[model samples]
Target: MSGFKTKKISKNPHQNPMQVSKIPSQKTGFSSKNTPENQKETSENILTSADKNKRRARKISGIFLIISVLVFGAIFAIKAVGNMQLSNNDEYKTFRQITDIFGDNSETPKTPEKRGSKNILIAGIGGRGHPGGELTDSLMLANMNYDTKTVTLLSIPRDLYVAYSSNSAGKINALYPMGQKQNEGVNLLAKKVSEITNQPIHHYLIIDFSGFKSIVDALGGVEVNVPKKIYDREYPNNNWGYEIFSLNAGLQTLDGKTALKFARSRHSTSDFDRSSRQQLLLKAIKDKALSLGILTNPAKISELIDSVRNNLSTDLTVGDLVDIGLAFKDMSNTNILMYSYNNECNGICMPGSYLYTPGRDDFGGAWVLLPENATRSRVSRYENMRQFASLVFEFPHLQNAEKSIRIVTNSKNLSQAKNIRKNLEQLGFPIDHQNAIVQTGATIETTNIHKYYDSAIGTGFDDNHILVEALKKIEPSISQSTGTGAKFATGTGQYIEIILGNDAKNYFQFKGISASMTENNNFSESNKK
Candidate 1:
């Protein structure tokens, strides 16, 4: 799990068939009871209608030659006042670092070469009523590619088992609880995410329980649609970890207080569902914020910004933020993608704990985890802080060629590393020189990839079907005699590395597991005991 905050954009990539980056649970602003799924959709529709209404209102008035100019003028003036306050707000300034003039000097990077798209990592700290922060409940990577006017947002689930900078591995959310005491909880979370995504995180904003509520409040209120009915007996609220917040399903309007509940509630749907709801609420908030004049009020902006200074941490300068605010100043609430990681990546799981790891024999077919295409793209962004498996599923040459060979490699082996480098080179993939991978256990994952798409929580893969089929296609070598290949394992071993092709061009790899692990016949609950 990493940074997972909501940002605004107008492009609808969903219609084109979405390949999504998940949204973290905490950064989702839906802690209210009113957010049923229907209501959520309706709210989105409302935003659209609002846009149309605004256009129509302006048009009719314009044709009448100031038919309603008197009213609009007064309204605009009132809005201007609030906008002025927010513009001058020091609190907001505190959170935004002025990259250009910090403490003294000025002049910031302007061109693409100098002022490239910056990456900001935002985390949501969850813990009730305490100045000392908590664990990072959600993770998100906000990539603003100013050059393309295309922003790439990726959400990392907190439950994702990832290797941390401390050389520790655990659920992504715990990074906060473990480090927040020192005020670097958010920093550690960002660093972990940076390691995984390979992207240099320029800034971090940590919003604890209260800060989250206030931001929602500042935006007036957010509208949403709750997807499922949720009933949690005792959820966290302050030091009390088991207080319940009940709600029915469907469309509804949520004020700040209720919005916090909805966003924070782990009610009906799975944690994945919670994350989805949170994403929707976030979009609503963004839409409202962009629509309202409050953003222009420098004074109010200062107050709102100041209100959360103690609650946030960032490396961004004022100029950087102001620029970002302006760029996104008119984001339409049209396009958004939200997804969640499933237990399939880890296999079977426990309620709020225990992500299981399976053995090889359990795998039903030859398979590769990452696609040949998105591998470098995913790796460069993560920067190697987290270990990634480029699963190498070997195919026996056709006509019952040689036995299948699955090579598991790690960042350790020198020769296989050379081969991997070759593979990538042949492929012409860009490598992020600053990959900060920290290897943990020696074993790589053994997954039944077919089970991946079939899982209850799958992310859909029409394009990925091609990758799967490609991995399964093994060209056979010349063989007069037919027989299964030999299997050998002598004694205590280390790690294994396998590479495909000569260079980066036709690259696929398996970089872990020195000795083989047998598959389990029963991963289901009924067969377990």
Candidate 2:
């Protein structure tokens, strides 16, 4: 197939239209009592316009007032974070004071805030203590939707392969060091991430290991549930040596030091597992901060803010931070969704299933994960991540629906079945290997597609229709029919099962693209492929 042909899916007739109402602005200024009653009436008459301009003017004025209030509130919140009172209305004093508090360099300009959904890239570095301490230890993106009160955290693995300037390539973490050497490390890293994920990062927040530990300590530590026993015998010690880091399975409250270890440990497990632990730890930290009422405690808040000021560096202003803090105050654990691009779940091993592990002769045998498309087409990891980000930010409703459709092929052509599955998954559908529906009956059949539903959930005609429409986009000849046999209705929930036939072999063929990669710090496609 050349391309997945777009189809016109019927809309859900029962979908409700959400209505929003605007608040009418109140008149604040009072008329002078010294004015004559007739003069007041004359003034009111003159103010009134002949047409709808009066209402339009009021709306314009109301919008301006709201913007002014937001700016004022943001500034006030910034001062409050540091336990500083907004005593006088002198703008210059406030500006100078904020500049001093945040250590704003006169040479660096402020980061401009976007009007819509904001994407902030956060980087955690080792910072001045350890060898290559400038290397990023943790990298995550916070995508915040101001109107929806929703947040999605995406973690980018440090070991992923990325191309730098002048055709130099290395691990994703190296971007920071390379950029720092060039005198714009943070901005360069942000630019590279934006290129990789195709999502523009408006601002970046950088904090070293000390700041992370201090912030946790200031918040009195965080609580987490250990899913399994974790014992890392090779955990790094401060003295440039290795030590054991163990945690028993169960609920436990960890101090700053232990929490940092829990997040950074990666001896027994892979980087994928480490990414998961970091996300869980973040959730626990948020929970602990809320439970301790850190926002309400001025002393603790000031200390925490000081920790940030002393150790953290960012282009975002105090007011921007305040605006973010206030906007997402009500966002709880449930409102947060997390995603990571690992070897599994929309990622594939370059030459095999080991993620980014290199061949013996390549890159001095250094391990790296290469990003590939459904057809094994060489593509940038950022391009792949951009699609995932779109699903999180722009297509939440479809993503929720897409996760429900599970494809199971019964045909002998495994290659075609796998290709179809990959295409569907790239489109945001959740297709799991464990959930792959197997064919038990005799294999005499043509290609058939159908939806399976339960009485408890009733008929998912709308969702099923969407699945069928998407399938038709890929294979225009798909026949939508009921499960006339015993095989289709076995699944519990709503799912789409594709019984592949010999016709699939003719439709899908994988052209082996031999990836001729050289043995250097950077990897790229060769013309020989």
Candidate 3:
């Protein structure tokens, strides 16, 4: 049977009304567990109680502050000794203490070099306790342009099939663990990710499950908008037992465990949603830590540093982090751009879906997602990845224009219609929701564009300069329909009408099989015969 065969997995009747991005699986069973206590209580009560506690803590903090000042002075006086070595000096001792609490400190700080862009690959592992805990659960590439202060977060799916070496082929997440088994570790993983993205991974940060939870707790928890209620009945607990985990849809502050659940829960949802949740949780953690003055308060900073020490590893020194913090301190939430690859677009799976194709591993016969035909790129996955990296890093301006586009395809090829829409969406267009797509089965001979309700305006002109300019990048000679019609009235500044013709196969760089493909294959087979 073809790997694309439709399959259904049992769902709890009480599951939320929101649809999940369907991920096919065999032998799908609960792997870990969470307790009933992990269930999220209504956020309103939690927030009210938290506010009261904060107010109370503020009222009594002065007493502790006064005592600490006196004790610090007394200790300094007692420790004052001449002829103390630099290593034994109290100032040096405090510096070392700070360094230890944080990961590491740069020995000799240097002037910040003017690098046009910086790329950092951040990976999160499940950590020590849980089964397969050491494997990376999330991997993201952060591309920051220091001059513009704009950042792009590109999330690579964990199940992406990448061959780290000629002899080794596995999920991208396994690269780190497999490296560790060979005693090479994260460095090797970084190299592999860099190669895949076709961009240099200047630095890497690996956070384990403990570090993630601890840091969130240190910051008094993070608030995230759970868009839809999540009910993972068989959520994994630490004891190898399943527990029901449920969270209501709302804006709520999540403590360490709850935040982890919000980010890591994948029973009903697919990895795309999980990646998005992880990104949201990360922003929430940053916002909370900043709001709570952890970055400014020495004590809070020390506490957080100590909390994450064992669970975080990175070559980034304290100085490096401080430099980064100061550079992007003024960046607001809007300055950050996020993109992820998904299995489907507009309720239709694109030809040769981006999600990995499941199959048995050649080495062990264990189930794994494998690359059959081309995935991201028409020729190879590597080409596809590099194309994505270039678009992200080189054309950072794409994020600047938040274009809400509605695509209407007039093509007999349903797959081609879906494919074009998927490509446009992948280019970071905010498609006007899922139901916005209109498919007209009528086939034309050449692709034509109707721009802003005007057809005869010119061969290739549109009042929406941004849309026209972006389209020119793909097809320079793309022409307008050259006739005024009621259909042209449907065009908006954000919307474009595409009448796909047979020639569109060449225009969109069409690769996947359709009527044209079948004919080509038949001819080739007959030639072989």
Q: What is the C-alpha RMSD of each candidate to the true structure, in Å?
A: 19.5, 19.2, 14.1
lDDT of 2 by residue, 1-529 (tens): 1111111221321111110111122110112112345574655355545325744643443343344445554345455332221111111121111111111132244344523566778778766555446667789887777656777777787766665532334557766655554455465677666655556566667777777888788888888898778999988777756789999989988888898898889887877778878888878877777687554444454456556554555656534654666667778777776666666544422111213343423333445566654211232434345545544444433334544444445547665666655555654555564455455345635766666544455665333455555555445666755532334536455566676665655542322222222213222344112
Work out the TM-score per prediction: 0.47, 0.65, 0.64
lDDT of 3 by residue, 1-529 (tens): 1111112322432211111122222110111112244557643335455457744653344233334434553223223211222110111111111111111122235446745766778888776666566667789988877867878787777766554432224456766655555445466567656555556666667787888899888888888989788999878777766788899999988999999888878886876778778888877876786677543454664466557655666655544554566577777877777766555433544322344554443323332343334431121244444445546565555645544444556646556767667765555544444644566655567777765444455433355455556655555677764233424225434345666667776666523212211111111112221
User: lDDT, candidate 3, residue 64?
Assistant: 38
Evaluate all candidate structures by whole-model CA lDDT and list the values in order.
0.41, 0.55, 0.55
Clashing pairs in 3: 32-236, 32-237, 33-235, 33-236, 33-237, 34-236, 34-237
Candidate 1: Cα lDDT at 525: 26
Question: Candidate 2 local accuracy as lDDT?
Answer: 0.55
Best by TM-score: 2
Count clashing residue pairs per candidate.
92, 4, 7
- At residue 297, give the lDDT of candidate 2: 49
TM-score of 2: 0.65
* CA displacement after TM-score superposition, residue 485 of candidate 3 (Å): 12
Name the runs in model 3 displaced over 4 angstroms.
Answer: 1-115, 345-353, 359-367, 370-380, 393-418, 432-506, 510-529
Ranking by TM-score: 2, 3, 1
lDDT score of residue 151 within candidate 2: 75
Off by over 4 Å in 2: 1-116, 345-354, 373-385, 392-414, 422-428, 432-435, 438-493, 498-529
